[model samples]
Target chain A: MIRAALTLFLALATVSPLWSQSDLKKLSDSEITAFDSKLKSRSQATETLIADFRQEKSMEMLKNKMVSKGVFKYKREDKIAFLYSQPMVYHMIINGQKLRILSNGKNQIIDLKNNPVMREVRTLIAASFLGNLSQVGTTYKISYFDNKGGVVVVVVPQSRQLSSVITRITIYFKGSNAEIERLKIEEGSGSVTEYIFTNQRINTDLTDEDFRIN
Target chain B: MRISGLISSILLVVSLAGCSPLLKEGIWLQNTPFAAGNVPYVYDTIPSTQIFDFTLVFKKSEVTGIVIIKTAGAGERRIVMTSVFGMTFLDFELKGENIKINYCIEQLNREKVILLLKKDFEILFKPDHSKITKYLYSSPDRLDALEQGNGITKTLMKFTNYNNKWPETIQIEHPYLRLSLLLKKTEYDPESI
Candidate 1:
């Protein structure tokens, strides 16, 4: 009887780690669902979001040379403007039907109806700008972490196609509120873009006419 | 006889005037063929070693930045390009006919640029015999005609209309940014010491 009890205790000890792992997984799933619920609720409450963004892009030339920097602006409902101030002066605006690029007093308009790449980029930016966090689950495997201030959501792309370009994206919020503090996107090619939001004014009087490509 | 001689002189002057502009235009286009040899070198033999500097300007939307490229290659061909601010962007190797573009920014749609550059480089150095023959034969006849003019030379041809040479100055007239690049101060080191 003593030998049998000792054998049973050893078997239980060996199985404990597996049980703990399953429990941890269950906890992670619950956290992810809760995080999704929080984002969905916040997005539903907000009407619109607008912010100023700075973008830096690096290009490799010939061997191992890199040069990068740029700035842009983002508004709610797929309105974006980019201005490159270095090397040259160029401006681009993506409105509803057209993508307009103005440089050297010349305007070139590309109809976005047939441009697949532009459509994809626009969709990605619009989804993020509108705070459609639930749609993010379609493309990414999301994990959530709760800290003192708010929630930190790390989104890793699920599809191989998405993962080939973007490795992960991290978004930070203030408390359980839907207000986002920052977003960082890391690419598989060892590039990162971080956007910090400040002085955010939600639902201020903004007209659709403001997005005209002038 | 005097009337006939005077008419002949006037006709000669008019003909000369007409021919002068045509000759000048011919010389202009000959001196600057829009696109010429792919790489900087003239011969088909790939050098054992090479070093050069390049400046690239990109205009997207309303933003513009200058990128400087410095390259040094040895053995099979290893290239290291850096920006003017000393940021290493791309490092790759080219062994014989194979090219490997090691690093590129993911956000930028630059795959086409890389493939084009690789093809151009291949054409520039160690050109295939058939392609070279086709290029020599099928090149624009206007360029061929311009080559006959006295102003253009094999060593150096200056363009009066556009202030740059082949493989040095690239003109990109985009809707967003019209860029003119001057590839200045080039040196070629051929010996592999």
Candidate 2:
């Protein structure tokens, strides 16, 4: 009897992790609607956000993942500053239709009016940081997954232009607060880039000069 | 007869000028081995794998991104370049004398461009020592230049400032295509994280 019990205990221990890993369940229609509204309300109430982010890019061919650490700041209306500090220094700031990039001591201000790629990037930034997936409802097919306490929102591009670049984008939001804890982008090239945000401060004081072109 | 002789002389001068090699034997040399530098052609040390912050400019358009070169196996390397905004421009696999484009964005999907890119990376990753016909060294800068050809166009590749056996920077230039690639190595300290 003791031997049977020991066998059962070993089996449960081995199988428990797999079960926990796959515990993320697909949310029903009503649950998704409620979650979407909560996200929208939280995003609307957020005036400013500042967070330190760690980015990991894993390619199929690479044995070692490329790791980078940076900080991102977002302001209401339209302003973002994404800065990388390690390995190399790269700063990308966006204000309305203007995109300013600083790298290798060179700075360039590119107008995003006719540039489809940059415009799409701007749209993505706004969707992930400023608004919820429901706000980008027209551009993507959105689905929700309940991962234990947190939620995972997966968005696939509805447009051919965007689909050619990315296969899907998965955003993980923490419980109750509708705060984005991570954003994972899967490319058509079989590589994945994941950004994990920490030390998030919402409604923080940020200035336009923070995202200035000059 | 005098005028014809003068024309013949002018034609001969022009032909000699045209036949002269684009890469001068010693004009690019700083030290000599009688004729010029007899330094043995040395290829850059094969690094484990490297990630570079690159800015690629062609014509008036400029793109800044990250480039990762991962050695897949023996004599094989995989190179991936992606934009800062998270769009992949290219994913290429280079095996011995073979190149495969796993993925490329539409903007850079042209035949001529792809051919040039393959040639560029080929020169970058594996400089053909067998095709090298001349070697020159600039002693002042401690740089080594190798002239490689395929019976038609010549390519000049230079490696300099090597730490141990690893080159700090590599420059590859193709005169005919007017294409150049400058690769600067970045130190990866896994323990720093």
Maximum-TM-score candidate:
2
Q: Lowest summed lDDT over 10 consecutive residues: which window, candidate 1 chain A?
A: A60-69
Show the colliding residue pairs in model 2. B33-B36
Q: For candidate 2, write residues A85-189 as lDDT tens digits.
A: 865688989899898999778898889885666676567667766655677658888878998777898888888876887888888999778888998898888
- Please provide, for model 2 over B1-193, each residue's C-alpha lDDT reduced to its tens digit, 9 standing for 90 to 100: 9999999999987875576564565342233352343344333335456665566665455667867677656568878888765668999888887888999988788987777666666655544323344555556334366666643356676777777655667666665555556666654452331
Q: What is the lDDT of residue A30 in candidate 1?
A: 74
Residue A142 deviation, candidate 1, in Å?
A: 2.9
**Candidate lDDT (C-alpha), each:** 0.47, 0.72
Writing each residue's lDDT as its tens digit, candidate 1 over A1-214 gives 9999999999999999877534432226776576667666666655555554443333323332222224445566677655545434556678876777665566767777754334544665566556665574576676666646476766787767557656777777776565777666666555455655666665655565545675
Calculate candidate 1's fnat. Answer: 0.07
